[model samples]
Target: MLTRIVRMAFQPEKVADFLAIFRDSEDKIRNMPGCRHLELWQDADQPTVYCTHSRWDSAADLDNYRRSALFGQVWPATKALFAAPPLAFSVYPAGVESSLSSLPASQ
Candidate 1:
């Protein structure tokens, strides 16, 4: 599984618009091929800041979505609402067994 994270800082005045766009398009995005999960999160102290967390089967899956017409439409609308450039990255599970083994057992 490939996890993708995107941080967006929207213009304060455009937050509602951004949310509306997200509401209208989230279902389509979540239903895309190879999309395993999707979630939106808001920063605790910043009302204008939001992030999208998603899981894809692979980077190529993500790339396919990015090149789709859905992205072409959504991204331009989303970009117009941003106060700053978005930050995005992808990561894979980092050996869960090794991390679990390092944990101490307690009663």
Candidate 2:
């Protein structure tokens, strides 16, 4: 599995509005090929900061989404709300150490 995390810092006063934009965004990415899941997170210490954690089957899957209209619409809305350049990381999952006899719960 491939994990992609993006960190975004927004203007403090507009944080809620910015988050709303994401909440109301188009469904293009959600229906894209290879997208396993998508999640949104907010920093506990910094309310104006948010992050997106997504799991894709591969890098190519993410690339496909980026080139689609879903990204085209979402990017501009997201960028306009940013206070700083966003940071993104992509990683491959390492082995998990589990003690459960059956399948463990998802992280």
Candidate 3:
């Protein structure tokens, strides 16, 4: 599995518009092939900062979504609302099991 994170900083006034776009397209994004999970996170200290965390089956899967028409349309609009360039990164497992099953139980 691959995890992707994108940190977006939007104009304060444009945050609502950005969120509206997300609301309208989230389902389509989540339903994309190889998409396992998708979430939107907001920074408590910086209201204009938002992040999208998603898990994909592989890098190719992520690339497919990026190249899709849905992304082509949504990205341009989203980019226009940004206060700064977005930061994006991807990560894969470190060859260790990090699931809840590997953790000790609570008292």
TM-score, cand. 2: 0.81
The alpha-carbon lDDT assigned to residue 77 of candidate 1 equals 98
Where does model 3 exceed 4 Å of error? 96-107
Candidate 3, position 65, lDDT = 99
Task: Quote each prediction's TM-score.
Answer: 0.88, 0.81, 0.88
Candidate 2 residue lDDT tens string, 1-107: 78999999998877887877777762456668999888889899988888999999999999988898788888888898889999999988555543343476789
- Between candidates 1 and 2, the one scoring higher on lDDT is 1
- Global CA lDDT of candidate 3, please? 0.96
Q: Please provide, for model 1 over 36-99, each residue's C-alpha lDDT reduced to its tens digit, 9 standing for 90 to 100.
A: 9999999999989999999999999999999999999999999999999999999988798978
Q: For each candidate, how many residue pairs have backbone atoms clashing (under 3 Å)?
A: 0, 0, 0
Query: What TM-score does candidate 1 get on C-alpha atoms?
Result: 0.88
Q: In candidate 3, list every pair of residues with a backbone clash.
A: none
Give lDDT: candidate 3, residue 92.
Answer: 82
